[model samples]
Target: MEFSSSLTLLNSKTPFLLEKRILLLEAILEHGSISKAAKAVPMSYKSAWDAINSINNLCDNTVVLRETGGIGGGGASITEYGKNLIQSYTILQKEHTKFLEKLTTLTDFNSGNLKSLQRFTMQISARNQILAKIEAINIDKVNANIVLKTKSNQRLVSSISKNSIENLVLEKNKEVLAIFKSNNVMISTNNVKGFSARNKIKGLINKLTFSEVSCEVNILINDTDVITSVITTEAAKELELKIGQEVYAIIKSSDIMIGN
Candidate 1:
């Protein structure tokens, strides 16, 4: 088997520079025109310009300089910073390639479990991430309502756009991670009816944490799973919330996100 890797620089969650953008920058340096560079990179002229603008906005210093009255109306040039960026990226890419090659050799040849590396590398701020299997999918013209079954036999539902269903390639019995934030979960002392939220799982309050403005309630739904909710301290006081008391966790289907 062969291993290859693409190097990218990110500004928080957004990508600042990638292999394709690097190629576009190189083409711009060679051709001296955005239009010619776009053609060389096989990207649209507008996309090339947008990439340049994005790079400039993310960096403290301007990277690409535009020149007027050059043969074809106007042209583009790379700054010293941009040239140094390319060289730095090239060096990093070589090291990245070497690291992946070593990783490939260490991987199990027959199993081909390289994709499993994501489980260790993936990190998010979401407090709840439940492993579930896709029990069913109800699709309409505009959206899809997915039903997921957890290991503890609890069924959770998520509502997503139809385009997302296609993009994620969701199907029955496929494993996925049901993700939601602690703040999005609502706690109820009683089985309240006529609520807009669709999901409700009854459990005992396992723990309670108090802060100046908010309270954290941890509910033990099963032997292995615990769901947490962050609610206002005023609400917690009004409800007289206590550990070991029975309560229900409520969540809206739209608030749940499905990740594979």
Candidate 2:
């Protein structure tokens, strides 16, 4: 069998860049019009526009610029930042090809050892994974405080070791995955002022499940995102949490883990 691979760049767990999307951007750069670019890529104009918007939303910098009221109505142009991305992706694709080639040579197809390599893939057990962008980073002698903003415009603070910042290459405007256990999330009915925890996001309870002692609370923070919290059944009953009820999800800064 022939071996081939496709390269993709991700922001947190979301796919930020793909081969077809890159082709769309390249076509836009060449044609200087979104409509023309869409035709060149064999994609619908709406698809092209949606792809651009998705990239812009995930990226720290705007990659495409739309111009209007020109000789030919309006046209779209790729920014310098977008051009740089194209170049970087090209380099990464070459490296990815080389890596696949080396791996193919080292593998024995009949040996069935590929199953062992599957175990090397990383899996996180954390129930809560929120996509966020690093807004700011403050460092002390021991720890670094990272300010993150979610797509819903909710701000979260994460305190991690200074060494972790260097290891993860964390910086301002970088997209990261904020992970924490569901048990670490505390649900409160009232918006407690001056709480010790750094994060207190107000959301509506959309789902609730209760067992003998534990209860699972799923709070809808935004139209597309939800936060899950595990609390004692007694506490949940005392708080009288129900579907459609608004509440706050509290979490400690130290409990939050940032992952790329």
How much lDDT does each candidate structure score? 0.88, 0.88
State the lDDT of candidate 2 residue by residue for 1-260, as single tens digits: 34688998777888878999999999989999988888899798879888989888877899989876444435989989999998999999999999889888887854545643553464889888887889999999889999999988899999999999989999899877788999999988889998899999999999999999999999999766689999999999999989999999999999999987
Off by over 4 Å in 2: 1-122
Which candidate leads the pack in lDDT?
2
Compared with the true structure, the alpha-carbon lDDT of candidate 1 equals 0.88
What does each candidate score in C-alpha RMSD? Answer: 7.2, 21.6
Worst lDDT run of 10 residues, candidate 1, spans 109-118
Model 1, stretches more than 4 Å misplaced? 1-117
The CA lDDT at 131 in model 2 is 77
Q: How accurate locally is residue 211 in candidate 2, as Cα lDDT from 0 to 100?
A: 100
